[model samples]
Target: MAVVTRTEPPPRPPRRRRLLYRLRVLRHDPTAALGLILVVLLAYLVVAPLFAVLSDAFRLQYGDEVHAGQQPGEWTGYYLWRVFRSQISRLLFWEPLVNTLVVAVGTTLFALALGGGMAWLVTRTNVPGRRWLAGALVVPYMLPSWTFSLAWLTLFKNERAAGQAGFLQAQGIRTPDWLAYGPLPIVITLGLHYYPFVLLLVGNALRRIDVQLEDSARILGAPRRTVVRRIVIPLMLPALSSAVLLVVGRVLGTFGTPYVLGLPADYRVLSTGLFQSIRDRSTGVASVLATVIVIIGIVIVFTDMRLMREQRRFVTVGGKGAMDRVSDLRRWRWPACALGMAVFAVSVLVPVLTLLLSTVTRIPLNLSTFTLDFWIAEELPGAVGFPHGVLRGPELWEAAWNSLRIVGLASLICAVAGLLVGYVVVRGTAPRIAAFLRQVSFLPYLIPGIAFAAASLSLFAVARGPVPALYGTTFLLILVMAVTHLPYSSRSGIAAMMQLGREPEEAAQIAGASWWQRMRRIIFPIQKGALVTGIVLPFISGLKELSIVVMLTTTGTQLLTTLSIGLVDYGYTQLANGVVLMIALLSFTMTYLTQRLTRSSLASGLGG
Candidate 1:
């Protein structure tokens, strides 16, 4: 017995035992297993495409053998030189880069001022119609950002681009090219479109700032300006910085507004420049541009994170709830209300009304020329190839159906996947796997939509291993939309789950409920509101998405966005406006219905 005991294996070391215990737990725990699977899937879907794009930038692309004097797939830095150092680099990359930086910085500043001012008015002041202004101001975000560009064109188009003269030009007021098409209009339109990002973020931050802090500063005999400068702004630095980063990141990637407003003036940003390269089949250059955009986006994201960490010292919120004190602007209340209404006029009412007017009349804002021809006429005059009104055309109806079907299915997939991801992130036993899944799911948001679409094309255009090529299929469109929009649903899911306790699942487990049963009966039912918000948010976003769709859609897989852009390319302004209105209507209807059903809103969902 002594000899047998002596020969027995020694007890495992403490660290090794802990590792073995973790392995056993992961093997047995269903949540841990699901987390592991999600990690692998997200890595493939999110990280692999990025790697593909980076590799393509450094490799000799097809037909570029002549240009690079190297074989395809071979490593070369020719694209780097062509985009950054070559003779044509000024036109191809440097100018676009400069223009992009200018527009992005300008848009960020403009959005900050407008949105921050509005947020302060509504959140911290006795501004008349605060509730109405709060909701109305967020409506612009629901419509496509390019909607503002279309409206801008309707009001200001000059003789630069060959088509219909804009309202101003038609009225014998010669709209300057600077006002009609270039950085000015681009910044104005984009800032208007994205200001809500700042509003929501800064509004939340303002609401959280303990009024006592500001009141204390005032009690200490600080002047109003000093109080704001010393207390309010420092407390607001995190939100301000976050909003700046968010707007800048969006401006960097937004393709439609720049394309519509900048193209006529040849004011190319990186996004439009990349689009041009892709259209030219300059794959290497496109890859390099896409890579650069992603790198810039990554830098922004990291900077945001770092600033957030550094600004933690400014936190003044405490365990006790603080009252929100409203500043009195007794005589200025009406003026503040008027200001809010003016913003609504510019950001929402004008754009919607302008697009509507453009669709119904050949000459926008000219009531005498009103007709239903663009919407319902059996045949459209002077519209060859697309001979029917948008309502009467097979193309419009088909594209609408495709958009609803593909985005619907994709949103459903996103909702379910997001819920599962949340479940794993919150309940899984494997911490490392959960964190990896969390991070990888968010990576898509960092990459510009066009770059992500390009990466997706590079990765899935051809088959690899057991996966078949998905180049021209509707499945690819659905897949890309799902991945690109996953962050919204995933964020909503995580936020919802954070408030959920584990008692229900634990009780169900004690009652002999299977993992699926617990999830289906316990988790799903409780998260219904979050699930709906997740689904509808992505549906709204993907329905109007153009940059991603433009890169992936072929003739067979055309979405409403691409359909509208194609009509624009064909110079069918009224019909394009009609399609755009249809998109806005659908998006608004979906968001309205979701909010009504779930008692949740775009602002709250996006904040999460």
Candidate 2:
């Protein structure tokens, strides 16, 4: 009887007891606790601001009180009406909407054609320079997208802009309006910058294709075109769509390129228009436009996700017999090599050389006018407040330091949080929680940078509960940078962690090592390369980030990207180009060093 009484399993432990048990277990288990905390934080940081943007779109804002005839903070459709139906709606919304679509479509097509071709050449064909060309083609992306715009302007700027004539125009070759500014240049520059994205995605997809499929078709007397059409094109469609969506999404949020190129022609896209609204203190208008961008971006992201799901259907599973066969180019080998090198020249060498040439000389490609003044002189003619050269002055150094410190800190945070998130995702017992954490962490990637920045500005511009108002502070920049760039590190972390077995961690745990001890001694030591890559990739991205931080940065908190933009605003072309060169060089050097250290390129982490 006593055994029967005790053997009832203590009345099956009350629900409260079971709940408390879980809580206690979670408290002891760092992964569960960390997962919970990250889910909450990422939801707040990544998802909350999107609601803030939508909220601001309908709710009356401070300056809109006069226009809406409603008190601030009150609900109204006036802002929506103004953006969609009012007199200036076309100018403020419709035209920019059209321009954004046009540019996005144009850029996507151009990027796909160029990137798809290059990917084929490098991965499938017997291209001579494939070894170096593969790495070199990714360089344009490391530099800022606007670097192309700067070069384009340096070479093609017309009298449409008030100040100095471009080199072509300076030599009495007046470039056409379309060549100098507006959608065409925006498309080309963005295409050049983003084609690497396509190359990475499609190229990886191409590499993964099983050559035996094609060989089998060929051995069966199928034509090469038939093999490509049936075997290759069908499999590549998903990657092609993904590349297109990525390019289009980037075009939607990109500010610097469109702003620099579009302004001269009075051409405006949604990003530049949103920026204008923010600058003009048209909060409601900005919120509306930002909401639209976010909506489009979310749609694109969902479509991409769907395509990715469908992509699994096409996965080429292979055994040890699988081999990637490179097609012999025969007499076309030299031509293919020449084409690859030519692309490298146009995309990497040309931009770098163009910026370098512009920095030292007022006139492009002119040796006589070359001077060290832009780099080291204490004073220069017509350069108003920025009297000293970029190299000689405290401004450039301070900005560089801030870029390193703020971006470095942000990236470090990203790396650590990403690693923790990966652990929680890969090793956690609670599937739902882990899945939620993964999705929430990645939500920021789908939100356009400009829209996210606007959302952040709207939500955190004022005090919200425990978090203080962070509008113009350096902390705000760090927070946004970390949150926006979290996807890269998180993906890298998850990929790295999936490959790491639990034996070491389990052994450490069995030896009575605490969770932190296990992570520090076991997990981190094994994932050092991934950790470094996580830090460096985000660092490079945030360093070159313009659209996101541009909205967040105030006069006191200028990053190199913003500082270069500021110089551009002041018409200090040489100094601005000098700063641009610095950014490109720094970005390239960091990427190169990270590749050397990790034995991996930026493309590895970016494959996600």
Candidate 3:
């Protein structure tokens, strides 16, 4: 025994062996391995482009080399100085930043007010048309964000912005400059488009609230105001915060509406400024503006995270039996119904009707001028860019197919990758890896789409090792869309997976099933609804996306959105509106079909 002990137990496994053993253990854990890979990939994809943009901010870019008196690719602070301290800084940075804040804050408030009221009516009160209102109100979100802007212009546009006066202006209505463009129109358009985010989030939370809590407070002789203030509002804080964050984050990066409405009015927002810089080939300045936008976005996100931390302390759900109670509006039921319908009208019906009217008329809102030429004629004589009817051209069909193929592939990748990411984050053995996956997957959401597009254009325009130059390629478009839209799918996947217990998977493992088999048979079957939700939301979003595809798509790879914008550029208003209506219809039809087939609405998909 002494000799055996003196032999050091026949030499224990080396440190290398222990390390290898640990790696082997990780390899056996598919979740850990997949999570590590996802984290690494997302970090490279998300952080690398950001670094490239940041580097550009300090380097002498192509056009800036002459201005800065430095060679291209050399380090310099000329761009930052120009953006922050130069004579034009107010126009280039400060004013735009102020305008951005105004729009963001205004849109958030307007959306929250309208959306929160509707959510209360539908989820809490005995509103006469609750189901109809619930389904109809979200239609605006399915349409392009610019849909309302275009409608507003159609109704209120004066000679300032272009070709012809709008319907109201044409009728000798003096639409004020403030009403037609700038902050008011931008806020109202964006508010209508984004209010559904609030409705879905707040409505979902309201539905999940236990009636007993409010009832208990009421039984204790608490006033209605107190019950709402102390019980309802506290429970609603998380949803309200989430809704506000979503709306604000969107307002920060949204380019289409601001570009369309603000360009004519000289109303500049950060997104518009970034667009102008990129368009002018001022990469250095563009990077600086982009950096600022990213900083603001990060600040907003951090603030939201802090609020969410506080939200954790106010959990309302308990083990006790919970019932949903609807407040009887009595004489106010019909009025509540009217109010809900009015929201639907402003948010959905009006914009859609205007778009449709514009697409069918040579002069929008003029019945006598309406014609089918834009939609079905053999040729549109004197139409500069679109010489034929929108339906008669192969361009429309081909672009539609490309949009479907490219965005469809991207969405499929998003769904699968998101599910994998969720699994790793929720079930992985390594906590650090999980946390990293969670954060990196969400990184794209904070970067403005235009900035992200600029970054992609810069980074992917060159080849690095195994990855080829992806500029002007459909693959590049697919990749960018997938990465940018990954947040929706990943959030949906994580929510679904968190509700799933590990017992079923453990049972499968005990039965000698492989990791892939367990996931295929047990995990996927249970989370199919979530997978569809993830896929559908991105598909809808990508189909109507204008900002991302605008920068990345070339002539050969035009999407529906790019096509629509091109028509707009060529001043073919009806053709453009036709394309837009098609986009809205496609998005709405797909969303409706998904809901009918899967029994999952946007509310459910978003965990409302």
What TM-score does model 2 achieve against the real structure?
0.92
Candidate 2 deviant stretches above 4 angstroms: 1-28, 215-224, 316-323, 501-503, 602-608
Which portions of model 1 miss their true places by more than 4 Å?
Answer: 1-29, 317-322, 603-608
Name the candidate, 1 or 3, with the larger lDDT value.
1
TM-score to native of every candidate shown: 0.92, 0.92, 0.89
User: How big is the positional error of residue 172 in model 1, measured in Å on the Cα after superposition?
Assistant: 2.3
- Model 2 residue 542 CA deviation (Å) reads 1.3
lDDT at 593, model 3: 87
Candidate number with the higher lDDT (2 or 3): 2
Q: How well is each residue in 1-608 modelled by candidate 3, as lDDT tens digits?
A: 35544434576799999999987665445676677678878987888888988998998987666678999989999999999999999999999999998999999999999999988888888888687788788888889988888788888888777555688877888888888889999999999999998999888888878889888999999999999999889888888998898899889989889987898889999988998887798888988988888888788788888888987777766533454568889999999899889989888888889989987877778989978888998887777667998999898999999999999999999999999888988898888988888888888887778778888776787887798999889999999999999988888888888999999998888787878888889999899988887788799889999888777888899999889877766766678788988998898898888888787666552211
| lDDT for each residue of candidate 2 in 258-349, tens digit (9 for 90 to 100) | 98899879999999999999999888889999999988999999999999999888988764345467788999999989988898899888
Clashing pairs in 2: none
